[model samples]
Target: MCSNYDSVTSPERLRIYFGVDAPAGSIKGEVWPLYQAPFIRRHPHADVGDDAVPPREAMAGLFGMLPHWAGEVAFGRRTYNARSETVAEKPSYRDAWRNGQHCVIPVEHIYEPDWRSGVAVPTRIQRKDGKPMGIAGLWASNRKATGEEVLSFTMLTINADDHGLFKNFHRPEDEKRMVVILRDDQYDEWLDAPADRSMAFMQQYPAQLLMATPEPQRGRRRTGASPTSK
Candidate 1:
């Protein structure tokens, strides 16, 4: 599951890369669940209808799927990562998927686990060439009883048992999985294509273009706190 990731992409680069006209305020550093991060989606045209909308624009949304009928924001915690295989069938994701509520979550890097030492170790994964990656995602609009609309999203993941790089991560007993990263050529197609055809894009990213580095766990005290420090 892609629970955390680096979201330091500047607004200027987001405009240039996604070709979005809407201004994207800076969302620097790591983004965790419930944080408002930039996402690119084709907004619905208010004057016209669902079919008519301006080009895909950048917007900030919470990093979890809070369905409209949900009573509280806490539901998001479990809806942050939607499995691609059952996305269309799952209760929390089926509505968004069938409605073509697709989105691209641009990020600098993603964090996963490496369990080689019997304990899960955090590792940062990034493109070998150093370009930003557009991860496939699903977006939703939740209307609250208090007359508020909450925009949220969830990353789509797939089984990666055969993936060379991704398979090296996660627990030994757990099934390996990875988020679906879209290529430059496939971005527009993924956002515009119908549900049936869009399934073709749900594949693992090539491991050749990726790299990983084990990182010191965040919040770890470097000195004077832990018993091992002395």
Candidate 2:
């Protein structure tokens, strides 16, 4: 399951690609569970006979989904990635799934561990075309005891045991999984698809269209002074 990724940080790119003029608020480039990031969803008035309104809109949301019953924001940490197979059955996700609260996460890249060498190495995965990926996800809203409204989302993942590219990551004994990357043309369809038809969009992205490279962990520094220094 994906717990971290790079969010699309360019407003121009968000406008040109996702049709979102700008993010709802400032967001960090590196995203982890519970981090604020942008997600695209069908406009609330899209079906309300407003021809002048855009069909889609971008909004800032926590990277992990929070069901209404969740007591605190911490609940998001464990709900960051929802299994597509069980999304409709899991209590934390079934409400959003049943209500068709579909959304698309604009991701620059996703980091996963590469264990081919008997050690875990961080790997960055992105589209071979170098364009942002529109990942399928579910969005939900909750109100805290303090009456603060929070918007959140979770990436949808599917089995990747036979995928040529993703099968190489993670431990060999662990079940392989990868997020569902939607095509450019399917964004609107995904947002508007009914609950029964949602499963139709859960297909895996073509492995040939993706590329991966090793990326060292961030924020590491030398422990002591330089050799030539004091």
Candidate 3:
């Protein structure tokens, strides 16, 4: 359900956190901060597995099915988040859930709306410690009979904590949910664990590390009921 996120951490910040040097040798913050819903980011080969083509490149086609895509012709309105609890049962996410289609959503923060008389009041969520959050994600590869590959991703959802709902920003009255957040120690398990074990790893995330607040959010709403947090 967590669709909005901030990936706009500066390259220098990433290098310091990672403690690794980049070849560019210089860095600065990106303009137009990385706030985005990130629906179907990078698109579909990412789910099935990578054998020949690079994984990131393999995912473009899958985004075609998402509602927010902005290609020459994009679906743009249908790109929605998937839920972690019931993903295995939904037709749109079943295959990825059962087949171990996993990924990581890296972000500096996420935006949620607090409903003030039906108006979505945007709020920002971030790691309690000021580090980046690595959110749980699902990926898939869409292949046709023609032998083309497409990759895509969707965030998983969970029930919202009291702080995550009423106290969180952009609180929509109709929805009470949030996304599954992974701990730094659980990143590898999330990305590489088998289907059953992966689910277990998901539960290990601590509640204390999760945090939220009111912050500016990006994206224009077209129409629909309040959406579940990714």
Ranking by TM-score: 2, 1, 3
| Model 3 Cα lDDT, one tens digit per residue, 65-136 | 232222312221233466566666766666666777676655577666767656776667677798876667
TM-score of each: 0.87, 0.93, 0.63
By summed lDDT, which 10 consecutive residues of candidate 1 come out lowest? Answer: 221-230
Put the candidates in lDDT order, highest first.
Answer: 2, 1, 3
TM-score of candidate 2 relative to the true fold: 0.93
| Candidate lDDT values, in order | 0.78, 0.87, 0.50
Superposed Cα deviation of residue 12, candidate 2 (Å)? 0.4
Number of clashes recorded per candidate: 0, 0, 29
lDDT of 1 by residue, 1-230 (tens): 87778874576767777766544554536777767888888666623655446567777778778877877876776787888888888888888888888899888889886899987788999999888899999898888723688788888898899999999887798888899999977887788777877689899999999999998564322331110100
**Per-residue lDDT over 1-230 for candidate 2, one digit per residue giving the tens place of the 0 to 100 score:** 77778999799999988998666677878887778999999999998887799899999999888998888887787788889888898988999999999999999999887899988787899999989999999999999623788999999999999998899888889888999999999999999999999999999899999999998674222331111100
Q: What lDDT score goes with residue 7 in model 3?
A: 50
Q: Superposing all C-alpha atoms, what RMSD in Å does each candidate have to the true structure? A: 6.5, 7.3, 7.2
Q: On lDDT, who's better, 2 or 3?
A: 2
